[model samples]
Target chain A: EAGVAQSPRYKIIEKRQSVAFWCNPISGHATLYWYQQILGQGPKLLIQFQNNGVVDDSQLPKDRFSAERLKGVDSTLKIQPAKLEDSAVYLCASSPSDWSEQYFGPGTRLTVT
Target chain B: AQTVTQSQPEMSVQEAETVTLSCTYDTSESNYYLFWYKQPPSRQMILVIRQEAYKQQNATENRFSVNFQKAAKSFSLKISDSQLGDTAMYFCAFVSNNNDMRFGAGTRLTVKP
Candidate 1:
């Protein structure tokens, strides 16, 4: 039942350069998320992990955004200096806990020009 | 601080007819949970139905259905018969019980065949 898995689906940087996104979840799942979909809007929760710690990131963007979920099954989301409103579509979800019902991945369309 | 409102940004069903997409949410936490995600165009993020706020029994799956009105907190989503892959971009989410998640600003359904 392979589901959540993301990486370089699409990306283009320039504004301040620096971008990174990657996720791999859905195998026992334990809650892991990182969303930010801004085309027409609808996804915005920048961080959340239940396995390698972090349960929430308070909308992240702590100056440059960051994320990690190492031992809890792949995860990574970074946006160093990118801007242009940080172009969007960087979803990555997984849940079998922390309330349940979530399974998404196939995003990573950052195009900050 | 949970807020998810999808004031129908777009809608147009014709395939087999039948469409209803609308959502309203602003939590005061009554044991939260409500979702209806579906973002096609290859962006993934699916899971078209979910509702559980004390569950007054309103959550279907087959042709997708949801009309949970927990005290008017509202939560609508009805897509029956409609097809053509049921167009996409329809989100309405909110999860709180301490998890605090939110998403909404979407509703671009168009399944006109």
Candidate 2:
């Protein structure tokens, strides 16, 4: 079975600019997640979706960051009016269910100037 | 709230040697899960191993093993016969019944030839 997939391995943007990252989950996976890993730090959960509905996004910065999963398979995370502190790697992961092991994809590295 | 901590910021070992990375976590939930993930320079967050809180036996996969101490709220990863391919940032993570996951600051491990 194929693992989770993400696009645009790298991106660069200036403060106040906008950028987006995409993810395609593993086949038959019911749960998808997005995480942000800043330089010198570990990845932190940004959002989670169970099927096409949001399960947890308590840590998401709703003011500038938003994400959506449609058809329960594909998802997108967008950051508008980016800040230099937003420079980090965005990782996408999927699990068969909320209680299953998670498989991750190569992340998209975002550089905000 | 749950928190994961990796006290070692960096560690090094010669090829074919062994090294261990330390991790500690705080959670009020009695039943939870712990994970060790490896992120190479490629930036793929790969699952190295996982352990369920209720399980008494430690988790091991191939050359990677974990020492899970529930009483102390500690989990340590041991890499045997380390290889250059093992050089990467290793993160310890935690998740409970609520499905909220927490991650540590990560430990950078470099295996020298």
Candidate 3:
């Protein structure tokens, strides 16, 4: 079976510029998540969606970051006015349900200059 | 808030030998999930193994096994007869049954032949 899919495996942007990342989760999976992994650090959850509705996004930076899972099959994460600290690997993952093992996609590595 | 820790930033082992990666987490929830993920040079996050918090027996998959100490909030991964292909960044993650997942800082493992 095909795993989760993401677009633009790598991206580079200047500080204060805007960047967006896309994710297409596995078929039949009900839970989708976005995470940020800084170099030499573990991933931190940005947002989570169950179908077309958000389940949790408490850790998301409301002032600069936003994400949406509009039809429940695909999702997008956007960061406006990117900063140097925002340079990291953005990962997308999906699971069959709320409490199950997750399947991850090849992350989008964003480098902010 | 749950937090996972990987005290070791890096580790090295000779090919065909064994190596263990340590992890500890802080959480009050009793029913949860723990996972180990491998990220190779390609930047794909692959699930290596997982264990359920309530399960007393440790989880094992092929040459990969976990030593889960629920009371101690410890979960470690043991790779047996390691191979060069096993070299990668390993992350420890926690997911409560409520679906709140958190991850550690990650440990980079190198296998030298």
Candidate 4:
């Protein structure tokens, strides 16, 4: 039973640079999610997808943050023109269904200088 | 909108001792789920335990247990015989009937040997 996979584990970029993170969810999972965790804070949901269709993305910064789950297996989150406040850990999680417990991946930590 | 709160920012315990982390949530939904996730320095979100709102038995997972108070909207995690591996950031999360998940600001725990 492989868990959710994400890459790269860490990243560094200057302010206003563009960065992207990738995620591969567990097999047979139907729900995928993206979350952002700032220093000393718990994760906040950025977007959610259910088999290539978006379920929610109210917290996502539409101006610079965008995500896509093509084919419902793998997903990517991108942040263009990164800001210092965007330095955080981006986590990807998957669940068997819309209401099941989630399995998370090792997050991608982005440090914006 | 649902909100979760972890009033404690940090806590320490002697090895083999017990420690408790407090959490409270605000929501109007009757049926939902609660979860406790552990994030070590590695930044992986590991689910420690979970509880369903309809179940009043609370949730116990080995040395980890939860005290869920529906009336008071409180969910607390208790770790007995805490080990060095228990040192991590603990987050309390909530998911409403619509599957909207929200998390608290996490509590950092350190176990001293």
Candidate 5:
């Protein structure tokens, strides 16, 4: 049973630039999630997917942030014209179902200069 | 809307000692779930323990345990025989039947040897 996987463990980009992060959830997990954690803060839910369908994404900034899980397997989160406030860690997690314990990825730390 | 609160921003416990981290939540749903997650410097969020609202008995895993008070809407984590590996950022989370999860700001715990 492999854990969730994420790419680009560390990224640095100038403010107003675009960036994207990828996530590969654990096999057989039906629920996938994306969260953003700023320094000294807990992870904040950005989006959630249940079998390729968006379950929740109210906190996501629609003007700049977008995510997709088309095949119900891997997913990607993108930020267009990133801002300095976007410098944080992006975490991916997966769970078998609702209310189940989630397995998390190592996360990608993004730094906006 | 659900909210989780961690009153303690930072705490320190000597190795082999015991320490407790306080958490409180506000939710209108009668049935829900609570979780405690540990995020080390490696940037991976690990599930420490979980508790169901309906369950009367507290949840425990190895040296970690939780004291859940439903009436007061409080949930506290207790680490017994604390070890150096327990040092990390601890976050309290909540989720209800709607499957919308919320997290607290987190508490930084340092286990000194």
Candidate 6:
């Protein structure tokens, strides 16, 4: 089976600019996730989706960051007015269900100047 | 809230030798899942091993194994006969029944020839 896929392996933007990242989950997987991993830090959960509906996004920065999983297969994460501290790797993962092990994608490394 | 901690920021081992990475987590929930992921220079997050909190025996995969201590809230990774290909950033993560996954600051491992 194909693993999770992400686009624009690297991205650079100025502070206050806007940026977006895309992800395509594995086929037949019902759960999708977005995580932000800062340099030297582990990946932190940003949002989670079960099909086209959100399961949890309590840790997401709703003020500036938003994500959507349309039709329950592909998803996108956007950050507006980016901050220098936002320079990190954004990872996408998918699982068959809430109880299965997650499969991750090659992350998009975003750098905000 | 759940938090994972990797006290070792970095480690090194000679090829064909063995090394261990330490991790500890804090959580109020009784049931959860713990994971160890590896991120090489390619920046792909690969699941190395996973352990369910209720399980007493450690989980092993080929050259990689985990020491899961439930009462101590600790999980450690032991790499046997380490190879240069093992050089990468290792992260410890946690996921609860609610399906919220949390990660720790990673440990960069270097294998010397």
lDDT, candidate 1, B2-56, per-residue tens: 7888887999989988999989988777888888888889989888788889879
Put the candidates in DockQ order, highest first.
3, 5, 4, 2, 6, 1
Every model's DockQ, to 2 decimals? 0.30, 0.76, 0.83, 0.78, 0.82, 0.74
Q: Tell me how far the alpha carbon of residue A79 in candidate 3 is from the true structure, in angstroms, after superposition.
A: 1.4
Q: Write the per-residue lDDT of candidate 6 for residues B24-62, one digit (tens) a residue.
A: 999999999999999999989999999998899999999
Q: What is the lDDT of residue A98 in candidate 6?
A: 76
Give the residue spans of candidate 2 off by over 4 A: none
Clashing pairs for predicted structure model 6, backbone only: none
Question: Residue pairs in steric clash, candidate 5?
Answer: none
Complex DockQ, candidate 6? 0.74
Pairs of residues clashing in candidate 1: A83-A86
CA deviation > 4 Å runs, candidate 4 = none
Quantify all predictions' global Cα lDDT against the true fold: 0.86, 0.92, 0.93, 0.94, 0.94, 0.93
Cα-based lDDT at residue B25, candidate 2: 93
Better candidate number, 5 or 6, judged by TM-score: 5
lDDT per residue for candidate 3 within A7-54, as digits (tens), equals: 899999999999999999999999999999888888888999999999
Segments of candidate 6 deviating more than 4 angstroms = none
Report the TM-score of candidate 6, chain B only.
Answer: 0.98
**In model 3, which runs have C-alpha deviations exceeding 4 angstroms?**
none
For candidate 4, give the lDDT of residue B20: 95
Q: What is the lDDT of residue A31 in candidate 6?
A: 95
Task: Please give each candidate's TM-score.
Answer: 0.36, 0.96, 0.97, 0.98, 0.98, 0.95
lDDT of 4 at A72: 90
Give lDDT tens digits, candidate 5, residues A29-103: 999999999998888999999999999999999999999998899999999989999999999999999667788
The TM-score measured for candidate 1 stands at 0.36
